[model samples]
Target: MSQATETLVFIPEDISSARSGAFRADWQMRSLAGETMGTHWSAKFSSPEQLDLQAIELSITQNLDTVISQMSPWETDSDLRRYQKAASGSWCAFRPEAFHVLERALSIAQETDGAYDPTFATAVDLLGFGPSPHSGYSYASPEVQQAFAQAGYQKAALSAETNSLFQPGNLRVDLCSIAKGFAVDLVCQRLRELGLENYLFEIGGEAKGLGCKPDGLPWLYEIEPPPNAKASLSKAQVALCGLAVATSGNYLRYEQRHGQTVAHIVSPRCQDGDDKLLSVSIFHDSCMEADAYATALFLLGAEAGLAFADKRNLAALFQTADDLLLSGRARKLLG
Candidate 1:
């Protein structure tokens, strides 16, 4: 990593609540702060908007966690549960903002042909991500498979006028589709509002770079598989500016099932796991789009993913398990 000309590590721990998914904020900022006079703003900043953004993020995450997380039994009592309680019924009222996000998710799902949707709640649930936090894997009933199999986001209905979301609709909305990317975008908005034009906004592995680092050069980062794997960036680096970059892969999120490696990413068409394209990195004007496409591309496989990206004029890179980075339209954009 090249030295950052100047860096600011502003982590207002006391001012911020721990709702951003145990992020790499502290350590990442510390790494950037090494031997620098950059201020670490763990204290409440002077700007009210900064505090407000933090609060909003925490609240949104909590509300989302309420729906998606099986952590607490009571969270099932939420609007999502309301739909489940209908006992083979009709539409229902939902939190307006939640519904908005859900509606967006469904739109992406429709556009992506179910590649990105809340329907995966069942797939993820079976993989051990609910109330227990990490359920690993479990033997599920055929009936359970049938139940979840029917839970596609397309089944849900949303009225912009009513601003509510519900099932056909027996499904619930999960924003694993775009929540982290949304949060990154929101943080960028907040930073811009605070006159912090030059900053890197990141949540999860999704990140957006704005302006240059305190140094004059553009912000740069290498792509690597999740930790525990040996260094895999191939000594290649991408400079990020005014764009979001995200990577999704299977090696780190796989389990042995039926004598095969069952990964988190389920192909909506095959209902099977796709392992050919180990990782996909996408860059776009919106982090949400980038994040969404990263997953979508992974599901698309190499040939189809390139075709989709080319058709959309999207810039993307797909890394195979063998460590070859294949750029689709993205190669020209990086220049």
Candidate 2:
């Protein structure tokens, strides 16, 4: 029988180098976890002082709650839903957090040429993957076609000065692809504000790490293998020092319809999910970017996605049924 393999990738750093001060003998590893956005979030950090764990948890939960209030499509009163309900041509003001996420989402949509549109909420709902009851609409159905017609990120406009978004006649916005990662970033920021530096923060599967462990070792994160992967497949892990990683795949959230496998990730380009690649993982300095890029690359497929990553010099790993493909930058990270 073939044995499984493991690959550790990291940027070389001195063992004695510590961004959060030299690891103290008294420093202890602390952990916290909570539920949010129909998922779980966790944190592991090194701290020397006797910190109030309860207070830290409260702050983290509050930060996550703020993201849901502003961006969650399931929340009827959320800023995103409110904007969706607004009449066309009217500009709706939003909180700084919501505005920031929307701005970034649009920027990415433009960058990927609508491959990662934020205005595909209607299509997502029609395909039985979103908050609304699925309409049982096929890709050729009128409902699905109309949804696709209206699903263009260019239709929307943002006013940075006012922190507002213009709704272009029933344009529905969904930030599901990027919101959770933003929440992770928010938690990391909160940790820093609380004077804790050496930490690994994660929401759902997206994660970001700061500083180093108490023993001066970087926090290591193992990429999740695809479902039913062979035992001989090599496991790849990266040291999460000052980096965030996100993975998108069809195996996690997909359904069978009429003998067709429909994934949850609805591409704006085609109004259907693309399962050509088993999964795509993106590594960046920001969790939000990593999360959005992972979804985009998954929709773009293996060939085009590889080209996109290479053009941007992005660190990306694309996994197919028979092969593991890494971008030029990704290959450099292997130790």
* TM-score on alpha carbons, each prediction: 0.70, 0.93
Q: After superposition, how far is residue 273 of candidate 1 from its true place, in Å?
A: 4.7
- Highest TM-score: which candidate? 2
Deviation in angstroms for 288 in model 1? 1.2
Clash counts for the predictions, in order: 8, 0
Candidate 1 — which pairs collide? 10-41, 11-42, 12-41, 12-42, 13-42, 70-131, 71-131, 128-135
Stretches of candidate 2 exceeding 4 Å from the true structure: 1-4, 12-20, 268-274
Local accuracy of candidate 1 as per-residue lDDT tens digits, 185-274:
655666665554445655556777655533344556566554433253343455555666777777666677555565655544424545
lDDT of each: 0.55, 0.83
